[model samples]
Target: MASTTPTQIDQAPPVTSSGRSTGRAGDKIFAGLSKGSGILLLVIMASIAGFLTYRASIALSKNEGNFLTTFDWNASANPPVFGIAVLLFGTVVSSIIAMAIAVPIAVGIALFISHYAPRKLAAPIAYVVDLLAAVPSIIYGIWGALFLVPQLNGLNLWLDEYLGWTYVFDKTQVGVARSLFTVGILLAIMILPIVTSVSREVFLQVPRMNEEAALALGATRWEVIRMSVLPFGRSGVISASMLGLGRALGETMAVATVLSPSFLINGHILDPGGGTFAQNIAAKFDEANEFGRDALIASGLVLFLLTLLVNGAARLIIARRKDFSGANA
Candidate 1:
């Protein structure tokens, strides 16, 4: 072997300084890019808000009806009359129903996939759920319109007959089940895959040591989940449910297909005469004049604000429980 000499050692390039300078340049570039991306997102959001506000103000100024209390959307009338009372009610009620139905089931399925099911079964089920999540909203709308509406008729009749005293279940007409209640059920199905997929991933992130310790303490499977899995994944579940709720709020085609859109607020959800903000906007956008278009824009503004409020609340909840979430782990 050739012996190394002082000259050879001294001839090595001064790479450390070069490397440090390159690293610093890269860091600055990355930081600047990240900051720019965030600012761009904020700018986009602000632009949307500004546009919606300007158009909505124009419509509201000329609105002959009270924007909050009036239930009729007669934008083309001699004195234009329109309000979001019925739309707000339908949107909120349908989303409430979807959340009520989807969240628990999604959580349960998540737990089952994470802890209960055998790996072979769990893999296939999870794959199927991901596929469901990818399905187009138009497909769901078509399915709801063609199949679900007719299929729900018998259930609607039963609910009306047995639960009539509840008022909400009482249907004024016995025709097709094209009511907000049916739309709620459809939205529930549409959002199911999303909530379940998020929740399953969250559950899977639970630390192995936590589950082992619980089992070592003589906890049953259910107890292990209740104590270790659930508390850790609570924030994630809330986030997933909030995402699903956002979809329910802005859903256009599916609700339009399933709900019989009218401008009346029927406290009876089983009745076929209510509408959602998105549904009404879709139903009325084409023929609406400039003022009518502005009216629709006003309704869109309400929905945009509603979605932002829901997401903000979810973020707050998630922040409060950050330690329990698996992110840090």
Candidate 2:
């Protein structure tokens, strides 16, 4: 074989100016596509915000009540009064309840699947969870309205009896559990699969070496998770929780179906009547006239803002703890 020399080395195949292994055309195409996709998403979001704002302004300009404080919505009335006070209360409270109930249980399920369950058990459970995530919102609404409502009366009664001192759990209404409390339980169920699936994937991504290091240090299985897995997956868990919360905040069909809609704020969550932004929009959109529709859009704008705030908060949390999120590992 010919011996290589300085001249031979210099005569080797010339690379493109960019010197990327994939060549300039491939790199440029991929970059353009990614940038374009991101731009398109932003454009769509902005369009929605603009449209909601435009319609909402029209509705607000003609409003007869304080947009923030008036308790009732009567878009069809002569003065056409409406406000989001009660709706905001219901939306925030119900979503908070959903997150409170779903997060711990979902995280536990994720941990069990990632760390404790055998592959045979985990695979089926994971598959079922994925299926649950795919189930339609309308179906969940129907299920909540029919099956879950009837079943939750006992739970409502129990909470009222024991937790009534807390005030929020006091069931003052004499009816089935078509209350914000019931809506929250239904929302918790709706968001559970989404949170669990994301958390499970995050826990599964824990570096094996890190886990082994914990074990080598005489850590128990739980201790290994506490020190190695939990820290690494904490950001991911927060992201998943925020994702679930976004859903809970905007859930329309299920809340409209299960929650007895009222225009007033009853502090007791277990009471029969309350309203949310999404539920109010969904329930009224069909029967609403042009102005009524705009009123609904105004409420939708509020829900949109709430969802954006939740996602922004999640991003901040993840950004703050990125070093411990296993990506560095």
Candidate 3:
């Protein structure tokens, strides 16, 4: 064989201005398409915000009630007096209750599926949980209205009897359990599968080597999970919780069905009457005139802003603790 010259061996192909070695046309096209898609999404979001703001301003200009403090929503009256105070309270309170109820159970189910259960058992359970997420919200609404509402009456009574001192649980009125508390419970059930699925995926992504190292240190299974798995998946759990909360906040039919709509912002969640933003819109939109529709849109805008704030807060929390670890070292 002939020996190759050093200059010939060192020779290389010329690169384009883009600095890509091969410079394939398809790569540039794909990159442009991805960037364009992202920009399109931002544009769409901006357009929606601007449209809602314009409509809301029109409605707010004609309002007779204090938009922030007034609890009544009488959008068809002489001056079209409407306010979001009750809606705001109901939405936030129910979502908080749902989060309080769902997150722990979801985390437990996720941990069980990821670390505790046998493979055969976990596989079926995970499949079932994912399938539950595919069920329509309408079905949950119907179920909550018919079955869950009646079933919860007993629990509501129990809470009223035992935990009545808490003020929030005090229910002096006698009626079916169609309160914000019931709505919250229904929301918890509705959001459970989504949170569980996301958390399970995050838990399953924990490195096997980290788990094994924890075990090598003579840690129990729970201890291993606490030391190696949970810390890695904490941000993911927060993300999952936020997703569930968004669903809870925006849920219309279930809250409308489970909660007997009311304009009053009572502290007794177990009492039968409260309204969420989505519930109010669904219940009132058909009866609304042109300005009333705009008023509803205003409430929708507030809901949008609330969701954005929640997501931003969650992202901030995750960013601040991105390096958190359960292990001291």
What lDDT is reached at residue 81 by model 2?
Answer: 94
Q: Report the number of the highest-TM-score candidate.
A: 1
Residue-level lDDT tens digits of model 3 in 1-329: 24567666567544445565454788898999999999999999999999999999999999999999998988888878899999999999999999999999999999999999999999999999888788888888889989998999889989989999999999978999888898988899889999999899889978788899899999999999999899889888998898899889999987887788889998999999989999999998999999999999999999999988877877876676556633334
lDDT per residue, candidate 2, 28-81, as tens digits?
999999999999999998999999999999999999999999999998787899
lDDT (Cα, 0-100) at 154 in candidate 2 = 86
Query: Residue 102 in model 3: shift from native, Å?
Result: 0.5
**Can you give the lDDT of residue 60 in candidate 2?**
94
Q: Each candidate's lDDT (Cα)?
A: 0.89, 0.90, 0.90
RMSD of candidate 2 to true structure, Å = 5.2
lDDT over C-alpha atoms for residue 51 of model 1? 95
Q: What's the TM-score of every candidate structure? A: 0.89, 0.87, 0.87
Tell me the TM-score of model 1: 0.89
Q: Give the clashing residue pairs of candidate 2, or none.
A: none
